[model samples]
Structures are given as C-alpha cells and as structure tokens.
Target: MTVFVDTSAFLAYLDRSDENHETAVATWTQLLHNRELLVCTNYILIESSALIQNRLGMAAIRDFQELFIPLLRIEWIDESVHQTGVAAWLAANRRRLSLVDVTSFETMRRLFINTAFAFDQHFVEQGFSCLK
Candidate 1:
C-alpha cells in the first residue's frame, strides 16, 4: 500500500522540535522497516519544504530532502488535478484549507488510496484513515 505522505507528517518527521516528533519518528521507522510504499505530490513536497525551512531552517529542509525525496513515488499531477482541488476546497469545510490539502484529498480519492499518513483532522473528516 502506498501511503500518502501529508505535510503534517513531513513536518513532524523533519522538525524534531515538533510535539509529535516521538510519535512521528516511531511511525516513520515502523513504516520504513515494513517497507511500506510511500507517495506524495509535488504540491506536498513544495509546501513541506517551505514549512521545514520556515519552522526549522533551510539546512534542515535540505537535509530532509536528501533523505526523503528519493523514497517517495511523487505524483506530479496536472492542471486538471489543480482544478479539481480548487473545487474540493470550496466544497470542504472552508477556504481555510490549502490547495495542497485539497489536492492531496482529491488525488487520494482518485487513486483509491484510503490511508493517509497525516496529522490533519480533515483527512479523517473526509472519511480516510489517518495514520497517526
């Protein structure tokens, strides 16, 4: 199964200062050991990298990418996905959620990936199993 690596999880993994670092690290280790397939979109990677740089530092973000990017099956979705994501955002709870979040949801729905490795409650609200 290919787990959708959400920004929340990516942040948790990269920022050791995070409150969820322990849990995220444990889960990450387990997943890696189990050889669980992983996936993400360029949408997620861009946001995640920026957040990592802002919250932690540019050095950390660079290091994280060196270790993480090759591990993911990046879904470079197109303009169609962006259009669908925009619609999903409007239909979702509010415009508070970003295109990355909405697109992650839409992409998951389209790919039939029911499990999302996310700390965001929106995933659960959207009827997907959030891997804590």
Candidate 2:
C-alpha cells in the first residue's frame, strides 16, 4: 500500500520531544518493515524541511534528509495541482486549514490513495484514513 506522508508525521518522527513521537516512530517502523510504499508531495518536503530546521536544528534536518527522505517517493507539484489546491483552500474558507493540506488532499484524490501516515486531523477531516 502507498501511504501519503505529511509534514506533521515527519515532525513527529524526527523530534523526540514531540507528543506524537512515539506513535510516529512505531508506525514508521511498521511501515518500513512492511515495505509499504511511502509517498509525499514536494510541498510536504518544503514544509517539513523548514519546520525541522527551525525546531530541531540542522542535525535533525540532516537525519530527515539522509535517513527518511530516501524511503519516500516524492510527488512533485505542478501548476495544475497548485491551482486546484488553491481553489480547494479558498472553498474551504477555514483559516486554520493550510494550502499544503488542501493540495495533499487533491494529490491523494488524484493518486487514488486512501491512507495517510499523518498526525494532522485535517487528513481525516478530508475523508482520508490516517495511520497515526
């Protein structure tokens, strides 16, 4: 199965202090053991890298890059995906909802991916099943 990895899950897995760290680690291990195909959009990579660098320092970012990044099959966002995500974000009209998240939803829909390895409730709210 292909699981969409989100920024929240990346943060949780990388930061030991994060509240969801333990669960994220366990889920990550299981996914890897099962050889599940992990995927993420370029948007998630950018968001995760920035957050990891800001909160955990360069070492953590290196770990994310060297250790975890290789396991992912990145889905690069294009003009069409960006435009659709922006449209979804506007239609949602929720301030707390992010454009990256709406784009993730669109990406998942386009890929026919039903599950996500994410800590964000927005994934579930958007009708996607979350691993954690």
Candidate 3:
C-alpha cells in the first residue's frame, strides 16, 4: 500500500522530543517492514524541510536530506495541484487548514491514496485515515 506522508509525521519522526515521536517511529518501522510505498508532495517536503531547518537547525535539515529524502517517492506539485489546493483553501471555512494540508489532500486524492502517515487531525477530519 502507498501512504501519503505529512509534515507532522515527518517532524515527529525526526524529532525525539515531539509528542508523537514514539508512535511515528513505531508506525514508520511497521510500514517499512511491510514494504509500504511512501509518497509525499513537493509542498510537503518544502514545509517539512523548512520547519526542520528553522526549529531544529541546519544539521537536522541536512540529516533529513541524507536520511529521509531518498526513502520516499516525491510527487511534484504542478499548476493543477496548486489550483486545486487554492480552491480547497478558499472553500474551507470551519477548518483552519494550511495551504500545504489542502495540497496534500489534493495530491492524495489525485493518487488514490486513502491512508496518511500523519499526526494531524485535519487529515482525519478530511476522511483520510491518519496512521499516527
């Protein structure tokens, strides 16, 4: 199975101090053992990398580039994806979702991926099963 990876899960997996770190690690290990295909959008990578660089420092970003970048297949966000995300973002009123979250949702829908490696409740609310 292919699972869409979100920034929250990535951050938790990389940072030991995160609240969901243990769960993310265990889930990641299980996915790896099961040979599940991991996928992420370019927007996700950008957000994750920026968050890691700003909060965790350049070394953390470097580690992410070296250790995590090669494990997953990247789906580059094109004009269509951006437009879809913008539409979703504008349509959402009750939910305070970020552009990245909407973009991820669009990417997942486009790829027919229902499961997400995420720690965000937004994914759950969007009817996507978040795997901690």
Best by TM-score: 2
Clashing pairs in 3: none
- When summed lDDT is taken over every stretch of 10 residues in candidate 2, the lowest stretch is 117-126
Tell me the TM-score of model 3. 0.95
Model 2, 55-131: lDDT tens per residue?
A: 99999999999999998999999999999999989998999999999999999999999999998999999899999
| lDDT tens per residue, model 3, 1-132 | 999999998899889999999999999999999999999988999999999988899988988899888999999999999998999898895566999999999899999999999998999998999897
Candidate 2 lDDT score at position 37: 94
- Candidate 2: misplaced stretches above 4 Å? none
Q: Rate the local accuracy (lDDT) of all candidates.
A: 0.87, 0.95, 0.92
**Global Cα lDDT for candidate 1:** 0.87
Comparing 2 and 3 on TM-score, the stronger one: 2
- Ranked by lDDT, the better of candidates 2 and 3 is 2
lDDT of 1 by residue, 1-132 (tens): 779989899888777788888888888888899899898899998998888888889888777789888889999979999999988787775756888988998899889999988898888988999887
